[model samples]
Target: MNWIILVIAGLFEVAFTSCLGKAKTTTGNEAYWWYAAFALTCGTSMFLLIKSTETLPLGTAYAVWTGIGAVGTVLMGIFFFHDPATFWRMFFIATLIMSIVGLKLVSAH
Candidate 1:
């Protein structure tokens, strides 16, 4: 059950961050909606994630949340918004993945 909440929190984290990025691109009424979605999703997700990480390992939960957010944002930038496909940037993302994995391993020990 906590895992389920954590997953929802992760999704909300992605959605909110993505919406915030989109909000920057949007203008007028749509921008307002995007901003609201971003705020709401982030706020709600953070609350749930805090509750979740209490039961889960702190390092494990945080690493997962941040990993999801970072990866999701970059993927959105590339596939959805046509950001440049730079090898260096992708390579750094791989670094982030490795760091997250390392964090999880450390926490398990």
Candidate 2:
């Protein structure tokens, strides 16, 4: 159940980031609404992430949460926002994933 919460929090992280991307693009009243949505998602997801850390080790939780969020954000932007994921970008992202996996393993012990 705790892990479930963590996953949900991570999903929210993605939501907030996507909203942030959108918020940065528009201007006037529309941007205000996007900013509001971004803030709400960020606040709510952060609270859930804190709750998640209650059961998981802090280091492990933080590392996984942030790593997953970063990678997921980039991948999502590529797919949804049409950001370029060239060969170099893919290589770097892959490296990040591997390093994060190592961090998780270390933190598990």
Candidate 3:
């Protein structure tokens, strides 16, 4: 369904962002490879987002998509990029999750 597609798109957004992080840590050919992955994932994410918008409300879809990407990228940062996982950061992430769920529940589709 469109929701699934939207979720995939969001994940791809995460992937692209992660690729950027990876690219930052590398050099020469490896950095180029990561950048290539970034481009591919970014394009795929956009395409899926456009497809999902056909059936999903643009506001809801965009919010959910960015929400997923934000949460996912933060987690990726904590796990992979050594980002600080402070208490306040986790609390806000949880709140963001709640907000995303709230949007889904209130949505008509």
Which structure among the candidates has the greatest TM-score?
A: 3
lDDT (CA) per prediction: 0.82, 0.84, 0.97
Write candidate 1's Cα lDDT for 1-109 as tens digits. Answer: 6666876787888899889889999899999999999989999899989988877887678778878678777888899889887999999989987886676566533
lDDT for model 2, on a 0 to 1 scale? Answer: 0.84
Q: After aligning candidate 1 to the native by TM-score, how far in Å is the CA of 97 from where it should be?
A: 2.4
**Candidate with more favorable, higher lDDT: 1 or 2:** 2
Assess every candidate by TM-score: 0.78, 0.82, 0.98
Best candidate, lDDT: 3
Write model 2 residue lDDT over 1-109, tens digit each, in one string. 6666776787788889999999888999999999899999899889989998887887777777787788889999999899999999999899988977786567543
> How big is the positional error of residue 43 in model 3, measured in Å on the Cα after superposition?
0.2
TM-score winner between candidates 1 and 2: 2
Tens-place lDDT per residue, model 3, 54-93, is 9999999999999999999999999988999999999999
User: Candidate 3: which pairs clash?
Assistant: none
